[model samples]
Target chain A: DAGITQSPRHKVTETGTPVTLRCHQTENHRYMYWYRQDPGHGLRLIHYSYGVKDTDKGEVSDGYSVSRSKTEDFLLTLESATSSQTSVYFCAVSAGVSTDTQYFGPGTRLTVL
Target chain B: AQSVAQPEDQVNVAEGNPLTVKCTYSVSGNPYLFWYVQYPNRGLQFLLKYITGDNLVKGSYGFEAEFNKSQTSFHLKKPSALVSDSALYFCAVRVLGGNKLTFGTGTQLKVEL
Candidate 1:
């Protein structure tokens, strides 16, 4: 919904291997965010971008990186996967920061062995 | 720092009965509160939001949330529960000056027949 899509809905990779997740939005929103969901932890922000080539760290940005080169795409990368990083990742977009409601993509389930 | 807390891990209600999922938040200045629902294997779906004006905000699927500024609470409620309403619910608060949102762990609602 919300014209959002995530590539590789499910993925499995070994620890120490690089992995990337893609989030695409057709809503032309100005803000995009990446978040990870785990049991008992709800969801934690990984990174966010306010505009192309402008990104910021979230509370749990460690060991992960993100890039937003265009208004429609935001990418999250795991330089080296870890078992602890295994979780369901979600991408969301908003028209603006204040008072704007976020719309989420389906989600990507990633597992690290 | 803005934060949200969902005190209950699980809430059970019978079909046709009223249901409520408690969510309280802490933030400086006025708050922007939101509620989202997640079914198994799906992404979070926006249910409702409270930006300003009336505290009682009605949302999709016959759901409503009340934002209580004095109590610092924004609880999700349904006048009558449906079996289809069983899902994981999350509450979030947006940062005052930023678009970033801080989320609560989540509450699993089970509506049984």
Candidate 2:
């Protein structure tokens, strides 16, 4: 298993509230990614960072934002949480040497009421 | 756009029986295919990948996948199934030179005792 950890294993928040999920990795990987897993949708990329301060939006980046100020931490924030944002969020890190393999964090389950 | 499909939502096999999970992909250029397994309450774990080498690629936990260029399929297979193998399996694909991956809806494999 990779040295990746996600904070707040589970959370329940009301609509219009702000939620933040954190992902930390001890692997010191260069590439980090945030993804959401929902029913009927396997896993969709929300945002990814190739390096510190270098990030890009993904297919489902409409309501989510990510930041990677350092190599060990990647944070995903929901500006104003909505019911549609209820899903399992996952963080992954890749060494870039082999893009084929990515190590993932345990995941965070968020529920919006 | 690159995409992956796992036709079955679930698969069942008794212990000692052979197991197979189907996956097909669509990509413009050469595809980098991968298989991952996820246990309950856990993140995705890398299983195997097909980069540019042999068509038959073996991975962890006695699992192997065959890359068929003509069919654009990378189906995972195991000669003997174990009850411990019961979990959710995901198929993913990345287009050449693309860092992002598109994943399938996932197939839940139930290896019965």
DockQ of 2: 0.67
- Runs in model 1 lying further than 4 Å from the true structure: none
- RMSD per model, one decimal: 0.8, 1.0
Q: Pull out the clashing pairs in model 2.
A: none
lDDT of 2 by residue, A1-113 (tens): 58999999999999999999999999899999999999889999999999999999999999898899999999999999999999999999998833458889999999999
Docking class of 2: medium
Q: What is the TM-score of chain B in candidate 1?
A: 0.98
Here the TM-score of candidate 2's chain B is 0.98
Best by TM-score: 1
lDDT of 2 by residue, B44-110 (tens): 9999999987999999999999999999999999999999999999999987668898999999999
Candidate 1 clashes between residue pairs 3 or more apart in a chain or in different chains: none
Task: Give the poorly placed runs of model 2, Cα more than 4 Å off.
Answer: none
